[model samples]
Target: MSTQTGRCYCGAFHVGTKASPQTVAYCHCSDCRRLSGAPVAAFAAFDPAHVVITPRWPDAKSHAKGVKRWFCPECGTQLGATYDYLPDQVYMPVGLFDQADRWQPQLHSHADSALPWLHIDDGLPRNAASSRASLTMASCDS
Candidate 1:
């Protein structure tokens, strides 16, 4: 498999993964929206073992139980996250990708928390919360 690469805005941090992402999705949870400063946040998840980080993040914050978000100290760029619920995966912000278009969000998650004014007309499945099943149904390799 071809490797995917990304870096923080200031180029202070970099990451690469040889494994294709397992799933890509738009997250509307409050933490995601607040941190991204957008109505929705998009992420592509891959096996943690396949992810190689340069200048590893020493500072991380857990906005809620089980989920830890890491940002670049130099640029404050939200780099990636890890969820206790999915211990085996690492979620990277799609915007950081060098080829962002390579992975498109197949679903909208945490739909119940979405802002009323935000309307995504993509026609993708909207789930009330984390939906691993929905991702599998989207034909993504587990």
Candidate 2:
């Protein structure tokens, strides 16, 4: 794993990791697009504790599904996505990184929510609220 660093658009959020993630993914869920204010959102999966986040909030403002979306309360910047089901890992948005080249997407999730103009040629596992979503529920503490 290579070292990677990231911060929010306004520098309100900062994260550091030793993750040279090549198996990243594209997410096209409506919630994601709306939340990110972009065509799509992409992230790299990593060990939850491998990341050292500063300005840590005791409570993160979140939107929940099977997972929890944490945002910077001050700036409303989406910081990272954490699975209530998978506590051992979390997905950090690639765009937040100052050094983003090491992580390249290997798959696309929520393909059905993808926009018409956007095209994904990569043959990866896709979910229109798919397995990742399902697995999240499956792994839940219900």
TM-score of each: 0.87, 0.79
Residues 92-134 of candidate 2: C-alpha lDDT, one tens digit per residue: 7888887767566666777777899987676777766533553
Would you give me the overall lDDT of model 2? 0.68
lDDT of each: 0.79, 0.68
Candidate 1 collision pairs: none
The Cα RMSD of model 1 versus the native structure comes to 4.1
Given candidate 2, what's the lDDT at residue 13?
73
lDDT of 1 by residue, 1-142 (tens): 8989999899999988898788888888887787888888888988888988797764787766777878888888988888775767888888888878879888888888889999889899888876766563111111
What stretches of model 2 exceed 4 Å from their correct place?
122-128, 131-142
Clashes of each: 0, 0
- Report the Cα RMSD per candidate: 4.1, 3.9
Clashes of 1: 0
Q: Which residue pairs does candidate 2 place in steric collision?
A: none
